[model samples]
Target: MTFKANWEKADKQYFLSAEIIEEMVRRAYTPKKLSSWSVIAGGCANLNIKINFEGNKLPSILRVYLRDKKSAYHEQKLGTLLKGTIALPETNYIGDYKGYRFAITSFIPGIPLRDLLLSHETYDMDSILFKVGGLLAKIATCPISKDLVRIPANSNGNSGFIRMAVPV
Candidate 1:
């Protein structure tokens, strides 16, 4: 099937049933009664559910890929790419379960940086950009693989991410 067709098909089947979540969990680890599963909002591209199973210490995030089936795999690769560059949720399980491409990842605590920054405190544009730049610097240095390394965007080029983080 084509990529566009696959994306549309996954979007139509967005709902992940409780039984299905349980089944996905079972494939990753020993199944336990799911204590709670709540949607984690504010994501731009995917469905994130903060789920807790009986006897688990920390919560796990169940992410359902909406745009593309390969999203889960790409994220798994990204986690590896950013392994030591910054703090990232460890992917516990990633698979295509019954046409639903998803991943169960270890929940990293704390609110998103966006929420933290946009709160009641008054932060000027430059301040936010500077702080965001620090984060970008870390990611900017992430290695794609042993043979290839990530190069910082030439501020002269059209990479907005580099420009936002570092004003030339």
Candidate 2:
């Protein structure tokens, strides 16, 4: 979808009324630079914005809350604390005024693994399978602990395979 259309879609989903948006811009925008702005890939929960200021690029991911203050605060706190400890995106900036809060983050590189696998033209008879296996093992062994965060009992952690344990 077009960028404006995508922003509108995100606004509707996140309950961002035009009045609210105008107010946010008025409060946040400055003549030389916008306090916050938009990025290329705008996500559902957060609208990513890249701002150019004084010849330095200050890119930020803007998270528009669908609800009131408390929900936004909780989301920001949890999200900020969880950064680096886990493999999630990093939050760089946070701002709240006029009942709307936004978050900014540094974008990461690398295409999705699913896309990579799907884009492969053919399955090689050589080391392709071995490389895939190694990648899977690396992902599986990534650091995780209950102390770090609670893993919901219902969550399958994005697994598509049948889960089974073979005792050694």
Give the per-residue lDDT digits (tens) of candidate 2, residues 1-168.
112333333454344554554454445544444444444453544543444344545443345653444544565544444443335556554567565676544555555334445454664625765866765565454343322343333464653322232333
For model 2, how big is the CA root-mean-square deviation? 11.0
Residue 67 lDDT in model 2? 41
Task: Write candidate 1's Cα lDDT for 31-148 as tens digits.
Answer: 5677888888666568789989898888999888777778787777677656656788988888778877788999989877656554666658588679779978888755354333
Give the local distance difference test score of model 1.
Answer: 0.70
Quote each prediction's TM-score: 0.68, 0.39
Model 2, which residues run further than 4 Å from truth? Answer: 1-36, 39-42, 67-89, 109-168
- lDDT of model 1 at residue 56? 80
The parts of candidate 1 lying over 4 Å away from their true place are 1-14, 114-128, 145-168
Compared with the true structure, all predictions reach lDDT values of: 0.70, 0.47
